[model samples]
Target chain A: MTFVNVGTLGTQPGQREAVVAILTRANPQLAQAGCLLYEVGTSEESPDTVFVTELWTSAEAHQESLQLPSVREAIAEAMPLLNGQMSGFQYQISGSPLRD
Target chain B: MTFVNVGTLGTQPGQREAVVAILTRANPQLAQAGCLLYEVGTSEESPDTVFVTELWTSAEAHQESLQLPSVREAIAEAMPLLNGQMSGFQYQISGSPLRD
Candidate 1:
């Protein structure tokens, strides 16, 4: 099954866009490493929150991508903007638009 | 910008698959209503939680979809199976794999 990750990162007020920019710039590198979908956005209901949704070929692929230098650097850059409140859940995708 | 919804629905033990099935069956109709991406998944870390990730052409498109008879029926059908614990956030997608 494909691996799915959906998470929310809470940032300091007005820092949401910065965190999103860092993640968005890292997408090309992420896609090169088996990321099927890498989407980043800011919450409409919460001005200080950013949402990250990802789909990978497999859990192993996602784990391996984390080891890539680009991803590690992006994480390091985003850490400071984060407000220390984040939550996420991992899922096994059974169906998706890509399948059709 | 597209509208993105990332949410988790908690179901009764062993009812996750049933909820997924219903949502999966509803996808074609959703797509016809401007749903760019509609995926349903089961959490790897939580057996009774289901994740729904969606992308729509716009927030208005999503709102209109909810008024569709088919969508309303699906929601009505899924409500009974829900454990009444659900949380979600809406976002404005600025970047996605589909863009590239």
Candidate 2:
């Protein structure tokens, strides 16, 4: 089953773009580390939040990713731009939405 | 630009699978209405919450989908299975995380 982690990082006022920039730039080692998808997004409705939807090979694969230097570096860069407010959900894919 | 709507649906006790069945079965009109993806998931961590990640051609297309008979019927059927609890984020995709 694929492991999905979807969440938001609340940014400091006017810092959402900077945070998003750092996020989208982080990918060199991700694919090698079992990342299947890492989609980044933002919204006009939620100016201070950056949304992410990720798919990983497994929950363990996702946890191990945090120790990679590239991920750690990216987190360091994005940390200061954030407000420490976060919310999300984790799920092991249950089924395909389309039967076909 | 893809319009993304991702959220969690709180299922009534032990009704998660029933709710998931209805969601995954809703595909006849979705693709024609501009749905790119409709991923349904459930988590062991949050047993009662069903997570969804959707990609639509536009927010308007997603809005219009609710008017479809398939969608309307699905919503009506799943309503009773839900606990009236929901949480999610709406965002416009910014960019691919891979800078290449």
Candidate 3:
């Protein structure tokens, strides 16, 4: 089963784009570590909220990626732009096109 | 551009599986109407919460899908299983492997 991460990041007013830039630049490095999909998006309903949807080979892989220096650096950069309000859930992918 | 729907559906007790079944059965019908991806998952952190992650060709395609008879029927069936605490966001895909 694939591990899925779906979360919301609340950013300061006008800072969502900057946070997204860091995440966007970090994707290639993340993909090399078993990230099948990593999507970052901005909500139409909430301008300051950013949504990150990810698919990884396993929970361990996701954890391992976080420990990578590049990922750590990216997180450090994004931290200041965040408003400290974050909500997310982890799941085992039960159904998806990739499975088919 | 792709429109993404990432939402949480809170089920009544063990009703999460039942809700997932309805959504799973409705997938093929949804795909026929331009749904690129429709993934349904149950959160590991919250057993009663179901996450629906979808990618549509456009917001219009997604809107048109809601009018389909089969889709309407499925929603009606799933409603009774819901706890009425639904939270979701509509996003414009900013970065994703699909775009690459």
TM-score for chain B of all predictions: 0.89, 0.94, 0.90
Residues forming the 10-long window of minimal summed lDDT in candidate 3 chain A: A91-100
Ranking by DockQ: 2, 1, 3
Evaluated on CA atoms against the true complex, candidate 1 attains a DockQ of 0.51
Clashing pairs in 2: none
Best DockQ among the predictions, by candidate number: 2
- Model 1 sits at an interface RMSD, in angstroms, of 3.2
Instruction: Compose the digit string of candidate 1's lDDT tens values, residues A22-84.
Output: 888835767777798878887667889888888888888999998988889888999999999
Best by lDDT: 2
Flag regions of model 2 displaced more than 4 Å: none
Compared with the true structure, what per-residue lDDT tens digits does model 3 show for residues B1-100?
7888778899999999888887777356677888987888886678898888888988899899999898898899999999999987777778863344
RMSD of 3: 2.3
Specify the highest-TM-score model's number: 2
lDDT of each: 0.82, 0.87, 0.82
Per-residue accuracy of model 1 over B27-82 as CA lDDT, tens digit each: 56677788998878986678888898888988889999999888888889988988
Residue B17 of model 1, lDDT score? 89
Superposed on the true interface residues, model 2 gives a C-alpha RMSD in angstroms of 2.0
Model 3 bad stretches (over 4 Å): A97-100, B97-100
lDDT of 3 by residue, A1-100 (tens): 7888888999999999998888877356677888987888887678898888888988899999999888899899999999999987778767753233
